[model samples]
Target: MPDSLPPPTPGEELIKRIAVRVREARKSRGLPRRVLSELSGVSPRYLAQLEAGEGNISVILLQRVAGALDLKIDALLAENMPLDRDAERMAQVFSKASPDIQQQVRALLFAHSQTELRAGRICLIGLRGAGKSTLGKLAGEVLGLPFIELNKEIEAALDMPIAEVLALYGQEGYRELEAEALERVSATHDRMILAAAGGIVAEKTTYVRLLQRFHTIWLHTSPAEYMQRVRAQGDERPMEGNPAAMTQLKTLLDTRTPLYERADSQVNTSNRPVKASLKDLLRIIEKRRFLDVLDG
Candidate 1:
């Protein structure tokens, strides 16, 4: 036998380092799993696995998680070495960037992400009360595909109610579980309709994955309608006595609108009956498939 064993692969080393750094940052920041999950759109279970050095995370996902923790991607990926002056400067630049500038920078990393889609999966993306849950299920039934709510998947993964998970592990933990749940569903099922969380667009990396792997549709409605719908559905959180709640929500919508608009298809379901909106969405899907066949 040789005097020394073979060295670890580059990929293996990277995974180990990422596992350590991600866990360290989470603990240092005093962020629980749910909080990180909400911010990064990565699942707590997956983050747990990553911290355990068992996660096979992609660079894109890692970058997203790192950005959420306010770290530079390069710094996060760096091996167990002290940060050089240049690296520190780069991190500072990234940390201080305007939101628009940061988005533009991140966009460069996904240049080749959307060349083709998995064809068998479809995702609904939009803000809360956009009717993703309702419209997504109808679309699934019409198309004979299984309808999956991503939040429900997160709960199942954690074996607890979402609120409990959030309360126990924090938002970071919840998002980590959520992202892993989405990944599991994507890997396990070939044909399904996913009703993603309204804030899915906030995490560009996860949203990019959704866009690349699934045909995405934006279920859109007006701000007033969105609030009314959520209230009507008995989700009292939106109506909590914050007098400026509507203003805050509208501001959030404004910021996310551009991201939502990037979907492959869009249905503005405002002021329309459910049947009418569903019919319009079905037509969109059918027409797209017909065109896809023509291309093929």
Candidate 2:
């Protein structure tokens, strides 16, 4: 008889667990390996090896895979724990639930988690020309709170400009850094005003984390004004050799409206002066008492 195979080593066992989780997640989502490869920027052959437990992927590559799957990295790495099976089933169910139900669930869960995590933190989210940077700065000064631009934080961390970061790491890498920058900001500052990139909503995991950890306000404007303001800021890329840019912008706005509506509040800046919109923002914050911390 053939000699018994040597017992699996600890590292081998860990790799097996990762392989199983990756395969299970991909299959459950009905994502073809090639599609996942495109989303994760990992080669199909690499993904194949990973799923077969014959590849040990780097953390950065693994992060890209997890983001593509809309899963937290820790979820793929955690050792067996009580109720893990039930938790996985619940997560799948939640993913299939209606948006209204998902919102209800998020409220129930985040209410407890946000009591301290979100206290006195405010985040402005919207397209580039929505006045997040200007208004966030003004409001922070008025309220005696710090103001931070999330992209600037990311740039500082990487020691490069936004364009360079994208050129170097692609969208997935930039998003991974975005998520990390957000977490760092949340951990370091309890009371600050933050301006977030408009496309943050496209990433479900990061968007959910934003909602869970800050009082978010969606700032909006008309498509015309959005374009005008962006041009005023010296960013002509939208209109540079793109005759259909306006149409594309409108379509994008329409698509992201639902996602933006998920914010806790909204402030419209259409056809309004800067000072007037600032007043509206301040009034809403006061009326909503977004900064008030309740005692346990």
Candidate 3:
């Protein structure tokens, strides 16, 4: 009998998987090997050998190739959770979709998924002084649901005030904490009223998760009213040592308007009493059935 070939080692199997994923991802995007090499800053010859499953590429080089192919390194390395052909094709299609179409697709998928992901969770989003805290508290009380301010959750988790957290961790660190805090909240609470920081929408991944997991309401007011309410809360920093504070505030409002508009609903609180705004907020919740979740 002819000599049988030896079985491939575990390392060899992993290299083969990586090779296939890289080649398939690159080809699906219509990227030539030379183009990929240029994008990844790895030699074309190395890429060629890697794709042929002969090269024992290092993790760093493989990471570069994965980046060039617009894939996570974990995607290439995962053994049990292999990407089926249909899913790979769908991922490519989704990557090229417009933002609006992508959002619609996400909403549709979330709606059809087995789990009630949103699960009666409601989030209020907008600039500070938009009555998120006030209305969230009031609505939670009336509806007999828990009310959570996401920043406060972060503060409690870190055992520090928000100002101290910001001072200690800087903005990037704070944002990381914010995202973690959001995840914690989502995992812990199936039904609650959440008031998120205004800037949460600036983080795309975190914001998308929030939208998918909660019925978000944009609590908005005129810039003037926003400033007035902030001052009324005994926060004088907005006007302290900033001659162009109002202008800066208006510019920020303009920049973030589109992001805030992505919320599932909006309540205008400009020139309105808290009680009246709370009524409108409650009406929106009832009219939109934000808290209703269909059983699987």
Candidate 4:
């Protein structure tokens, strides 16, 4: 509806425009097809067939279609003026099909489309408190698969808090633990939602390891929001005022954005509600048939 947009490509757009307009009007009227079918004494399946145009819909079908679509029979038959050639062709193809054939074609097309969009090697990476645990758990639940927090594996193996390990053994020690944990997970062939440390990608070996094994997604946010979300979760120590903290954060974000951009996908959580963000992430995963991608 915005004027700034370019005009849609001709033909296919026309079919979509008509189909979408009709669908929108039907939804706005809030008239369920079942009720319309009952009112017209037509079976639900017959009404669905007519609406979807998967059968030889006739003048008799028009009455039911009109009623279901909450339009006059005349309106149903009204000329879709200047029908786009492509839409017209598509309409003709659909109209010529038997109901069973239409269903088969629809199913095959749907399956093929799904195959193209499925996800590969999914791993969630972000700074501490960027919601790797929360979102990873949610993703796992929604995906009906195992959820793994890499830090948990590290801590379990080292018998210490992650910070303690970092402090006592230093960065190299932590990297070793991280590498080992990553190796264990990489060997397990399954649909797993991994919550990875933010800095892991800075380590060449670990970064390459993750990219090799999982489809990585960066869960990113504005520094201010990241601080707020993290503090709200009681990880307030990171926010201890240092005069250069903001500068450091800015540099980190600038540097990391490029690294994270290497991910299979990136999700910005700054403006979104957590629930909505989780749902969006899940939708992306599902759209890509992430599990199938992993297997491949």
Best candidate, lDDT: 2
The residue pairs that clash in candidate 4, if any, are: 117-288, 118-288, 119-288, 121-214, 121-215, 122-215
> Which of candidates 3 and 4 reaches a greater lDDT?
3
* TM-score, one value per model: 0.59, 0.63, 0.62, 0.57
To one decimal, what is the Cα RMSD in angstroms of model 1 from the true structure?
A: 18.5
The CA lDDT at 184 in model 1 is: 75
lDDT of 3 by residue, 89-168 (tens): 58779888765456556557777752366758899999998999999999999999999999999989989999999999
Whole-model Cα lDDT of every candidate shown, in order: 0.79, 0.89, 0.87, 0.69
Model 2, residue 14: what's the lDDT? 86
lDDT by residue (1-296, candidate 1, tens digit) is: 77897898898888888888878777877889789988988888877888898949887888888877777677668665323445556657877876545544544543444323356678888998988899889988888889999989887777888789889988676667666776777766667888998877877667776776678889989999999999999888876978888999999999999999899899999999999999988898887761241222
Over 1-296, each residue of candidate 2 has an lDDT whose tens digit, in order, gives: 99999999988998999899999889878899999999999999999999999958999999999888877687788795222445766787988876546655655765766755576999999998999999999999999999999999999998999999999999999999999888778766779999999999999999998988898999999999999999999999999999999999999999999999999899999999999999999998888788888666
**Collision count of model 3:** 0
Model 4 spans > 4 angstroms off: 1-121, 293-296
Residue lDDT tens for model 4, 1-296? 86697776654454344444444545566758677667777777865654553444456755655565545554444445322335445656876876545544544554545332223347898776567788889878877778888888999988889889899989998888898787776555345788898889889877875775577778888888877777788865765867676678778878887888888777778788889889878877766556674322
The order of the candidates by TM-score, greatest first, is: 2, 3, 1, 4
Q: Roughly what TM-score does model 4 have, to 2 decimal places?
A: 0.57
- Model 3 off-target regions past 4 Å? 1-115
The model with the greater TM-score, 1 or 2, is 2
Tell how far residue 39 is off in model 2, in angstroms: 61
